[model samples]
Target: KIQRQMGSSYHPEVTMKIQVPFEEFTLQIEGRADGVMETDEGTVIDEIKGVFKNLDAMKEPVQVHLAQAKCYAFIYGE
Candidate 1:
C-alpha cells in the first residue's frame, strides 16, 4: 500500500536490493526498499506499511514500525 504509493510518486528508474548491518545488535537486517527517488532536494527512501484492522490497535505496532523506519533512515542515510 505505502510502497505502491511511493512507487507511484517516485517512478524510480531502477530497483535494487540492499542489506544493512546494525553494530548495536547481533542481527543482520534485510529487506528491499521500493526504490530510490532522485529529486532536487535529495535522495529519498520509500517504505510501505499496510494496516488492516482497528485503528486503535495500531498504536503499539506503530512504535515498532517507526523504529524500523528510523533504523532504515539511519542506515540508508535518508
Candidate 2:
C-alpha cells in the first residue's frame, strides 16, 4: 500500500550491497529496503515496517529505524 502511494517509480524490495574500503577495517553492508524511489531531488530509501495498531501510537521514528534509514542513505551516497 505504501509503495503504491509513493508511485510507480519506486521499485519494490530493492537490495543494496555496498563495500567501503578502509585502511585496515573494511566494511561491507548489504540489505534489502522495502522500496527505492528516484526523482529530480535524489534517491530515497523506503524502510517499511508494520506494527499493527502501534503505528498510530508513534509520533516519531524509532531510534533503530532512523539509524537504519541513515545507513541506507549513506550507502546510497545521498
Candidate 3:
C-alpha cells in the first residue's frame, strides 16, 4: 500500500550485509531494508513494519523498529 504511494522514487527490498567490530571479534549483521531512496540531500533508508494498533493513536516509533532503521542507515553510511 505505502510502497505503491512511494512509487518509482523508492527501491524496494534492499539487501545489506555488514560486519561490526566488538571487543574481541566482529559481528556479522545481514538484513533487507524495506525501501531505499536517493534524494538530493542524501540517501534515505525506509524501514516499513506492520502494526496492529490504530495509527491515529500512535505517537512515536517503536524502539526496536527505529533500531532496525538505524542499522540500515549505518550499513549504507559505511
In terms of TM-score, the best-performing candidate is: 3
TM-score each candidate.
Answer: 0.48, 0.70, 0.80
* C-alpha lDDT score of every prediction, in listed order: 0.61, 0.81, 0.87
What lDDT, from 0 to 1, does candidate 3 have? 0.87
lDDT of 2 at 65: 80
User: Of models 2 and 3, which has the larger lDDT?
Assistant: 3
Clash-forming residue pairs, model 2 = none
Ranking by lDDT: 3, 2, 1
**Model 2: CA > 4 A from native:** 1-6
Q: How accurate is candidate 1 locally (lDDT)?
A: 0.61
Score candidate 1 by TM-score against the native: 0.48
**Residue 73, candidate 3: alpha-carbon lDDT:** 90
lDDT of 1 by residue, 4-77 (tens): 76655564333333454578655555555555675679877666778888987664667877776666556566
* Tens-digit lDDT string for candidate 3 (4-58): 7776777889999999899999999999998898877988897878999999998
